[model samples]
Target chain A: MKPPLWQSIGFYILVGVIVLQALFPFYYAILTSLEDGQALFEVNYLPRALNLANYQAMLSGGVFGKQILNSVFVATVVVILSLFLAVTAAYALSRIRFRGRGLLLLTVLSVSMFPQIAVLSGLFEVIRYFGLFNSLWSLVFSYMIFTLPFTVWVLTTFMRNLPIEIEEAAIMDGASSFTIIRRVFLPLMWPAMVTTGLLAFIHAWNEFLFALTFLSTDSQRTVPVAIALISGRSEFEIPWGNIMAASVIVTLPLVALVLVFQRKIVSGLTAGAVKG
Target chain B: MSKTVQKSRLSRSRTRSAWLFLAPMLLTLAIVAAWPLGRTIWFSFTDASLDLMGEARFVGFRNYLEYVAWGDGEGQYYGLLADARWWRSVWNTILFAVVSVSFETVFGLIIALVLNQQFRGRGLVRAAVLIPWAIPTIVSAKMWAWMLHDQFGIINDMLQTIGLIAEPIAWTASPDTAMVAVLMVDIWKTTPFMALLILAGLQMVPGDIYEAAKLDGVPPWRVFRKITLPLIMPAVLVAVVFRALDALRVFDIVYVLTPNTDATRTMSVFARENLFDYDKFAYGSAASTLLFLVIALITITFIMATRMDLEGKRS
Candidate 1:
């Protein structure tokens, strides 16, 4: 049953290609971030020097540090808010057999597919009306349109698979719906909640258009927008080193999270897509 | 009779709680999604300027199409439908979506098949494949932009060293290669997602079937074509459709990698330009409305074509 030597070699070579293609860009980014001045201009395949000057410059700048914090706050609040709303809504959608349930689920799915630009003009007006144009709340508010639907869909799918026996027992014991959800379902739903929350956090963190459109100030911008707007005085002086450093700093945390919760992330993604 | 009454009471309470639980979510959707979408569609018909949105007068379809008559039957059309740039963006959007999604699916299938094999360090390989997907889109765009830099980029340097070309090409700046650069970056980033989705489907195909096929001396290529491909088609189709819809709305990559270039301006970018930069808010609204309609039409056709079991009847 063993494969031929040539075939095995070919397979291994393909695997090598896949691995190299996947990891090289990020690796090069890290390499570029460590190089400065003349070294950056000349492309060296290997790391010649261990330098923290770019990282030092990036962190020493007050605005980049603040932008990172801005990104963290926005993504964190978005995750927490969307999870709370989605859990309750998922309970209703999945556990209760109500009229229009199918239609309602379809609505949620379609909303997730909405082009964000479609809502930009009106949402811009809404933000202005609420006096939230320059604030992080604008992002928090607008981000719900994208985050809520998937969270609700994935959680509903997850919630529906929970055993009914426990809920039935609780119901027979004269426990309220909220009480059963609190006592019986909450513990069981943690893995799903974590997965959906992480996805939501990433979506909010990486959101660019809305963040770029709504927040005009440097200090209020998220990391994605800030990294995008990172520039020197002129086109010729575009700061590639600082830009690469900022890119690496923001991406490392996400990479770690994906690697750590690798299995959960896969299951969460499949449950959201393949199940539908 | 007492038992029946209790059951009815329980059902009633459940429905009530369902409504109560859904209330907050519905309200948020209304505020964030439904209301704004309605306004956007409405704005598409008005002469709404960014600065004079309040005093905007209703102008029916003028932003979409307006034909001004000139003497001797000579005339010119003005508006989104008549604008060559708008149509160009539409073409660009469709082309980008088709090209990116197709490549991603193919590459994704290849990667998924490779990863499906029993090998050492499979977890590490899978994680490595996921690195591109895990990176933020903007960051990846920046990374690729740096690498694809005309003069100082390593991509050009390596290509030259490898004797691929005579000179380093300006990837993001040149019109001929801008879209190619965008697609390269997009395929690199999204192929992992497609692969993961297909990998999920691959895992569902029972191993015993493959074993049985092997016992029958079925060739690996035939087994893949006849069994594996047929089995994973559903997952692959769903993933392709998702990726296509996503690609149609591609903004961040094109916007970051090649800005202000007609070669890569997508519908989302074009709409945003008019909305803010061009001071043609209503015109932008019309463009966005068209984009929505295109996506909506595709989504509806897909749902109907697949006859998706929205009620979970299959489950």
Candidate 2:
């Protein structure tokens, strides 16, 4: 019943291509980061000698420590603000009979998809207006546009999918809709809230354009933007060692998160993709 | 617990709390997403630049006129839509999206099929595939950039060692190879995403259908073409549209990989240049608004197509 040789070959080839392609760059990055200073330019398929100098320097530089803090701070604040905003909006749309609920939902979703460029100027005005330019808070607030709409929409969808009986029972006890949402809906939708929060955190952590545009000071830059500029400054030769070291520093957290919560992360990403 | 006596205060409190719960979202939407976007559209019509906002005045369609597929400062250096650099970027973007998504889908389906089988090391392989999608875009882009370096890189060394090419290939540096390299990196990074989405769809498909097809001795290709594809068209469409919209606005990977070359520049990059680099805020807003329209059009078409499929199924 097994297929012939070609089938197995095709299967392995497909799988091999995927794994090799995905894993090779990371492996190469590691190899590059580890290559001895003397053999850094050695055009060998494998590193001639191992070197921990890059990692040593990167860690001692304190540049990475600040970047990590920036990433965490931005991601945390964005998630908190986004979830706080999205939950309320979702509740209002789900429970209350608003005249323009559908229109508002559509508007929020569509506006969220607008290119960052369109909002760049408007946001610049707002950011500079608030004197919040060149700080992590500016980027976090700007990320609300990116993170809030989807969180609200998805939370609303989750709320709608919940069992109606609990809310009905609460209302039958003469509890107001607001009371029902607070006590009944909030706890029930906690998983969706976590999922939404995780998604928002990852997006904010991964965001680069706003980070690059808004955060001008070296100390204020988030991980991605910091990593982008870490390799070279003006008139300086490109530093591959520092670049690899920084890449690993920034990338390791995400990889560790994926490894620890692979199932949950995958479920969240797939849910966002499938639903959208 | 009855609804008559104590209801007086409860209903009032409930209404007040509902409003309280709603205030944050309404305020955020108004202040952040809705207001910024609506203002962007209005700003697109004015002559606004980042450095000189005091000079900002209503220019009424001048920004749109500037985007009329020309390169002239006043009216563009006389070009047609087909040949306009920005429009060319759009075409290249579409080509990239179409090629990458189609390849990723085929490759993803094949991988999904293999992983779907009761094979050894399946869990490990699935986890391995998901790693790329898990990595942040900047990190992966930098990794690829280093790996594709003209000197001291493994990719060129391997290809040369294997006699694939006589010269070291510049993956992201050269204009000819830049887009291809980006396409490669994108395919590498996103195929898992396609696979994961399709795999979810595959799980929704009953095992019995394939069994029935097997019992009928239908050829594998035909079974796939007729049953698998049609059954999963909904999911495929969803993934494809998502990929397309995202691809249209591709920024970080290209930004990291290439230094804003014309051959590899995407619309998002172009818009970024206008807004940040050139300080042409109004013009940048116009270009990005156009990009949003393009994505919206594609989304609408996708929604319409899916609706058509659903209606056809119902009928």
By DockQ, who's the top model here? 1
Q: Write the per-residue lDDT of candidate 2 for residues B211-249, one digit (tens) a residue.
A: 999999999899989998898877777877777777778
Q: What is candidate 1's CAPRI-style docking category based on DockQ?
A: high
Q: Interface RMSD for candidate number 2?
A: 3.6
- Across residues A71-180, which tens digit of lDDT does each residue of candidate 2 receive? 99989999988887778777776665544556666677676666676576677778887889987789888898889877887787777666667787877777766577
Cα lDDT of model 1 by residue, A1-276, tens digit: 688899999999999999999999999999999998878888878899778899999999798999999999999999999998999999999998989999999998899989999999999999999999989999999999999999999998888887778698898899988887889999999999999998898889899999999999999999999999998999899989999999999999999998998888888878888986
Candidate 2 — what's its lDDT? 0.76
Q: Total clashing residue pairs per candidate?
A: 0, 4
Candidate 1 is scored at a TM of 0.99
For model 2, state the Cα shift of residue B304 in Å.
Answer: 4.1
| Predicted candidate 1 versus true structure: per-residue lDDT over B1-315, tens digit per residue | 999999998998999999999999989988999998988999999999998877778999899999998987999999999999999999999999999999999999999999999999999999999889989999999999999999998889988998999899999999999999999999999999999999999999999999999999999999999999999999999999989999999999999999999999999999999999999999999999999999999999988989887776777
Error of 1 at A19 (Å): 0.8
